[model samples]
Target: MKNIQVKWWLLLLLIISTTVSSCEKEDSGNAGRLTETDFMVAAANSDLFEIQTGQIASGKGTLSEVREFAQHLVMDHTTSSNELRILANQKKITLPDSLTEDNRAIRMRLSGQSGVAFDKDFIEVQITAHDEAISLYEQATREIQDPDIRNFATKTLPILQGHRDHAVMVKSKIDSF
Candidate 1:
């Protein structure tokens, strides 16, 4: 009788342990992963910042090249933002809708400038923003476990590189003037 009681207790413990383990796994699902979620949020914020700053540059920049580049940024980032939003929705990720404090400060600073100064500042901001975005996307491509998010990062990287190259070229031209 005692042997049977001991066996039943062990079985009960085994069942309890299994149930707890399964619950823990379920609670920590894919959506809880920081790498994927962080990448989406950061990407969303980046797109918003680019679109707003590009709009400002398009109107305030004195140089045609700067205005044209700004227009491209506005268009491209707007498209990217929409795509990201769809992806985030599909993945059940909540993305930020507005700029971060740092981005807000940059936008404020850019908004206060005009003419040549505005052109130079805008180009400089573009270069820096593209560099950071490229880094984030590249990291996401490497570290993200979600196949869809990784694919998004992979697809967007080349476009970001192109933007960075264009920004550099524009900066050189601005410096020469």
Candidate 2:
């Protein structure tokens, strides 16, 4: 009878342990990634980087097409950034006023180049940045816990995808030249 009682107690303990473990796993997952505040900051930094790089290309690019593309980047990214700022303001989220360290490094590298080199490097940067932006917005749309942020992501994703497609096309043209 004691052995039977021991077996019942062991089964209960096993179930309890599993339940606690699963709960911990879920909590840690939320803590680990895709937090709303982190998403906002990242988005803002990307916008700032795009704006700054586009401004550089506008002045330094030898290719007229590259200059035109840079103008588009400046206009579109400015609009997106303003909208994001408004949203962040409404949500009481503070955004970074400058680019992240990685983007600042890109800006410095692009600043050192001019003419054809500048044009090529700027196209490459746009392609990579837009790709990353698309992925980030897509992930936020899918997994963000905050309703306002998720909705924003869903609305912004198509625009980011469009930018990515444009950048890819521009990169291909640059490669062919």
Candidate 3:
């Protein structure tokens, strides 16, 4: 009788432990990502890095301009990514660090092009990326609940819009070529 009671208690404890462990695993999995707004920011920032990297590798632009522009991209995106990561951590939200499939497709297309073709594609994607960024940031500026986050969105929107303008100008010229 005592052995039977001991066996049942052990089984109950094991089941409870397993249930707790699984719940912990699930919670941790959900904790590492960003909220929707931050996620979109990170996604756009990732594309910025991708474009900079592709441009640097292609070496298509005037060497000085290419290097300077690449520096700006890397610094800007790195700061954005880090900020989003911090926010995600605080919010206990998981963010996708890798580019989405569509972004990846664009990256692959850019990788395949050379010289003027690469420059045109790069500028074109920059316009689209910044357009999306501005739209999303504009929405988030109004919608986000956190004061700091809302401010971040609001503050970043104009810079993104400016980039979009520059991209549009460059793309127009490239299209002419």
Candidate 4:
């Protein structure tokens, strides 16, 4: 009776182990060809560009600070986007030339507003977008299967975090003003 119980316990453990390992394998994305990661990176880059251009072009907020943040976004995201472009090209992942419809619609909406209204709205969007981006980067840092893709996420995470922090600070001022 003791032997039977031990065997059953062992069998359960084996089943659980197999299940966990299989889930890990599937989550890693088929030997890390980077299809999903690349798509996400490309889309993120497009959104960054869309927001940067729109804000810089139509921004009415404390122009000095908005200009500073706009410049940083251009510099940091452009560099990261270029790295992503290189990786995508090497991995043969297709890259898009423009932002998706949803992001474009957001940019158009921001462009339509003016003065403090536009400033507040744009800052809020930046805060929300950076927060979302931080989470995405954090997940990619863990779940990305390819060494290269994982490294890119790791390298870019601090920069994204900084952007998020700056955005939050600016947002508070924009909101209060």
Clashes of 1: 0
Q: State the weakest 10-residue window (summed lDDT) of model 2.
A: 164-173
Against the true structure, candidate 4 reaches a TM-score of 0.73
Worst 10 residues of 1 by lDDT: 27-36
**Residue 41 C-alpha lDDT in model 3:** 52
Best by the lDDT measure: 1
Q: Write the per-residue lDDT of candidate 2 for residues 1-177, one digit (tens) a residue.
A: 999999999999999999999999999977757878888888888889989999998899887778888888889889989988998999899999988889999999999997777888898889889888888888888778888888888987887777777777777777777
TM-score of each: 0.81, 0.85, 0.65, 0.73
- Clash pairs (backbone) in predicted model 4: none
Query: With candidate 3 superimposed using the best TM-score fit, by how many Å does residue 68's alpha carbon deviate from the native?
Result: 4.0
Stretches of candidate 2 off by over 4 Å are 1-19, 29-33
User: Clashing residue pairs in candidate 1, if any?
Assistant: none
Which 10 successive residues of model 3 have the least lDDT summed?
Answer: 61-70
lDDT of each: 0.92, 0.86, 0.65, 0.71
How many backbone clashes does every candidate have?
0, 0, 6, 0
